[model samples]
Target: MERVIVAGGGLAGVRTVEALRAQGYPGRLTLVGAEPHRPYDRPPLSKAVLRGELDDTTVDADWTALDCELLLGHRVTGLTDVLETTAGPLGFDGLVIATGASPIRLPGDGPQHVLRTIDDARALRADLRPGARVAVVGAGWIGAEVATAAAKAGCRVTVVEAADTPLAAAVGAEVGAKTAPWYAEAGVELRHGVKVASVERGGLELAGGGSIEADAVVTGIGVRPETSWLEGSDLTLDDGIAVDERLRTGRPGVFAVGDCAAWWSSTFRRRLRVEHWDTALNAPEVAAANLLGGERVYDPVPYFWSEQFGHMVQYAGHHPVADTMIWRGDPAAGGWAACWLTGDRLAAIVTVDRPRDLVQARRIIAAQKRIDRSALADPAIPVRDA
Candidate 1:
């Protein structure tokens, strides 16, 4: 490939460029990003940035040393043999898709905000003054995080979730309900099974009748792949650009990585679209290798972490909703984990305040090792030994 173009200027795009260089691809490379700022860390947007603990989370990468063209503030607008951007059309022998995902905004004219960018964090942080009434829609990871930061900032926060409990859709009702008490413990209101009809500035209209007054309303519902520009393109877009184990999008010299990819996972025996930092950080390596005529499959036991309500939550591996979950420690008491096992093989693990369990469980899942159920259940026992 004489000229390679990587779309998107997030962590995945930067890593993809780095991976290509590391694999000794001495050719012309161009990186296009929609944001004016260079690629930066995103996880901090919800935590450190939102808390006003940080202003910039820019990735520590020397764009100069990378010897590639950086087209900041240029968004990919169209695609084909010739890729079209806001700047203009450009030809490429190869392309890497790392556009990532965009937050799904609710229909509203409200003081609604979604934390996805640095600017978004800054905007939301300003409204979270002491004693400010804040209504956060959704009790998922982002919602929980925003509530935590708002409460810590002295804002009276209330979370509105349509589900019965927080994280119900993600980790299932049983495990998600285990975390319900955290909201109340943190002095935040948790309203479950309530749908928001509309978000209007200064108030939120409930599905039925009542309305909740608020100074600010934040939506943390979810995100969708940022592939609208690629519509009708050659790539197969199944929730995201469908790709095989090698990250190939069924198109010659074109590949996808990070959140915008639904890659085949041999380990899970299905396709997975993991929109997490670890996936964006690691998947590019395999994609870069495969791009450079190397035969490699990018299949990893999915992992993600969230810092909410003074708890360090880490999860590893993928298991079906029906998998038997064995509790390693008491959730009500703290420092607990929910381990899922199929037969004797470890399927997945959700850990809270138990770093060692998460650490060991990650390795065990990576190795696809069988576990001793009894030992695994004992919190006193190390996950590795278990």
Candidate 2:
């Protein structure tokens, strides 16, 4: 392909272009993004950005050496014979869909802040004044992180969750509920099993009766694949753009990666749409290879990490496909890990402030070999040897 257009000028798009050139595709590459700023890291937006510890999270890259055309502030609008953008129509021999996901906003919102961009973080940070009452809707990763930063900023923070516990939808209730204490320890109020009816100018209205008064309100209800532009197209859109093992969509010459893609995983025997920083960082290489006519399979053991309440939470592999969960240590302790297994083989791992466990589990999980259950359960033993 002479011309390749990468939609969404985020981390995934940047990596896709870099991968294309690294794979020796000497062609015209164009990076398009909705944001006006250069590609930047997003994980710190909820942490360091909000804490005012970091002013910029721009990705360290020499765009001049990449030799690709940059289209900032250009949003992909549609696709047909030619790719449509906010700028104008553009023809591409190959297209990489990396438009990523958008944060879900609260319904009937008033002064609702969602952190998905650097600008959003700055705006939210500005309102996080000392003693400012902050009511965060949702107890997920984003909500927890926002609460952590707000609490650190001396704001009276409270997290509201519709589920039984924080991260109930991600990790199971038993494991997720264990983290409820962290909120109280961090001096942030944790309210579970309550749905937010609406967000007003001051605070959130509970689904039941009472209301929460706050100086600032933020929602972390999760995100949806940004595929509105592709809705009119013949492209198959499931939870996201449905792609095969090679990250290629049914549409010829079009590949979907990043958060906006739900690629079939041969490893898990199902489709996975990983909206994590790790996915955007690694998936592009395979997508780029396949886009350049390389028949590379894009199956991966999904991994993601989150920082909340003074804990470094890391997870690797897909636990939903696993059958058993074995704890390495007590969750009440400072550092602990849970191993998800399919029979005797490792399927996933969840580590809380246990970096070494994650590093070891990742290597062992990639091997796809069975281990002794007793050995794996023992925290003192090496996971690699398990």
Candidate 3:
């Protein structure tokens, strides 16, 4: 039997090994992870775990009994087809790089936090107090979620973003403009178009010589793909390790998945790296299959969800150049669907507190079918039917 070595035993690594077995690949699979703990779900790390709704005991996975060896807490210092780890030199016929990202940290003084792991969430959650002034450095998904959680815990939240609108880069201007009011309604002081110059002991300095007082600062600025170990490898790295449509890297007998992998997206016809939990979980199925001699393609509709300030935001599909924005209901009304259309077809949809609409919009994107603009704007009409 062939031997397969999996690096970075997060969701993608764990799932890929399980998938290899499920696909009848009778190979010796070894999973190496930097974290000491076993592979756990990360989405909950930001939401339920951070809010004290879940515990560490509940984060354990059910696949430990699989026919594989797990090198937990071991970091792969170098990669050469033969990895040099803290344990020793290990080799394999095939390798899968699934190392995820780390939270961006600011160089500063006291008690600043970034929620990426259980320890991080626990530390931040414990320090959160009612009526404390909480300042968030970024307005991305992580920033919004943390700010929302802080507000719910009775803390005064202030979100600072360099962009003119929050989430302008991810979701377009039209959508970002409408969604901006949620911060003020939730009692959060939203500071837009301001770049953070530096962080001091008491507060953060703004670019234009202003300052924001912060009792506790939480930075969710962004995350870079964890691919530094592959510096000597022959794999191409542009933002991430560039892989083919099958998730195979430039080298033979090697594959990459999750945030560290920049694979070709058939839906958008471009090379992209997705960092969402869903992508991390589902992309491995394709990588494993392809690695096990089954031809499989990693074509997926990008889907992600974020919960904040008593509202659930869900979106699917790629909306790079959405020329028109269509609204099914009023966001101020709490439950509504916002659709982004490129020319005539559905490019993407952001549904606030509406799961069914997001699901239907995903189907529309997958089908590559154009929806009637009027039908999409009407709440009475179902998105699937449109």
- Per lDDT, the best of the predicted structures is 1
What digit string (tens of lDDT, one per residue) describes model 1 on residues 198-239? 998787999978999999999999999999999988889889
Considering TM-score, where higher is better, how would the candidates rank from best to worst? 1, 2, 3
Worst 10 residues of 3 by lDDT: 57-66
Better of 2 and 3 by lDDT: 2
lDDT, candidate 1, at 121: 92
User: For residues 99-180, what per-residue lDDT tens digits would candidate 3 score against the true structure?
Assistant: 9888777766645788877778888888678998899998888888898888888898899998988878778666777778
Q: Candidate 1, TM-score vs. the true structure?
A: 0.98
Q: Would you list the clashing residue pairs of candidate 1?
A: 110-201
- Candidate 2 regions off by >4 Å? none
- Clash count list over all predictions: 1, 1, 0
For all candidates in order, the CA lDDT equals 0.92, 0.91, 0.84
In angstroms, how far off is 102's CA in candidate 1? Answer: 0.5
lDDT score of residue 351 within candidate 3: 89
